[model samples]
Target: MPRAYEEIADERQHGRDTHVRRPRARVVRDSGRHQWEKDRARRPPAVRAATGATERDTGLLPDDLVFSARYRTIEAPGELAEAFGVCEGTALLERSYRTRYAAETAPFSLVTSYLPHALAAANPDLLDVSREPWPGGTHHQLSTVGIEIDRVEERVSARPPTPQETRELELPAGTAVILVRKTSYDTRGRIVDVSDVVLPGDRTELFFTTRLERW
Candidate 1:
């Protein structure tokens, strides 16, 4: 009877078992097949360019990309750190200019770049020195008028748009804002300008052209 009871228990345990098997993963040996799969995976899903891709393309124009710039004076580095929530060391000078602009129109604003502009404004003496135009080829229009750029530092950040910015900028869903901190220096290597710009990635383009001489 003990043997019979053990046999019954075994039968009960195995009663619900079904005959099925999962397919094992196999490694393909053909180099061509493996390469083809890799290439297919790397290819972009759609033919159209992804968001923010057009900023690098030359065909797009600056006006086509909607943006805005707001200028302000930085009183204290600690105050700036508190207002922007950035590190205190990040704010360098005692006084600086801040300019903020948009990265895209339909989306939100992103702080794409930053530089100091007040150092130049502080000392009118160094404004006459001709500094190279930003991105090259273009003439130094500002310097010609007694405004020189010495050095520029940039900081970038991203966050969701405010309710007013969203309605005014006409932002879309799942969009991000960019903030750019720009600092400019004079010929004496003094921090002259500081500005902040915000941009939306979906509807904005940043064009940078550099002219290089033959090496």
Candidate 2:
């Protein structure tokens, strides 16, 4: 268990409800992040375009804005490997990131992405951490080796931020977070990538739209 959760568990042992805390910030709803309507899944190009547009719309450009990425590959945890339908010891490419507006001291969010080593090794670029923020994003990179993404799946849940997460997001005390696990599948139904995003609940809103066909 994460230390933060451990702390909460310890507190629970003493008899206390942790849900009474109020959030202290707000992040605009991410339509792209939460939407599944019309198969409007988020791709790499869209990510860059959205981020760039956001910076532009906010009156900041190359001179005043910057985006940074830090990543690496690590052995997949048992559960993570299971998510990829692989054995426990499989190696997976892991990329950790922190994106932020230059003027702000805190990052916009914390993201960690993973790709199975066997799949990514097909294209050397995928294994090279320095290749990011790959001009087109993961979708384009995968396309280099003839992989076509057919769909995306996202599972969302909420929990109190861990000590590490709280410090990284610069979240205030009593703030919980929204946890998003996004999975990408290829035309062959193979899980190509999985990304975990941690969004500050106080600063984030989720929206979904569903359309029903006319009978």
Estimated TM-score for each candidate: 0.37, 0.74
User: What range of 10 consecutive residues in model 2 has the weakest lDDT sum?
Assistant: 33-42
| Model 1 lDDT tens row, 1-215 | 23433444455577743332222111111213222322333345342122222232223333334433333334346755554345565633332212112222133332322223343354443232232112211013234345455444556677886776566545566767665665555676654344555665445444334457998
Which has the greatest lDDT?
A: 2
Q: TM-score of model 1 relative to the true fold?
A: 0.37
Worst 10 residues of 1 by lDDT: 22-31
Each prediction's Cα lDDT score? 0.39, 0.68
Where is model 2 more than 4 Å wrong at Cα? 1-64
* Candidate 2 per-residue C-alpha lDDT over 168-209 given as tens digits, one digit per residue, 9 for 90 to 100: 888878989899898988899999899998988766667666
lDDT score at residue 18, model 1, on the 0-100 scale: 30
Question: Which ranges of candidate 1 are over 4 A from the true structure?
Answer: 1-145, 204-215
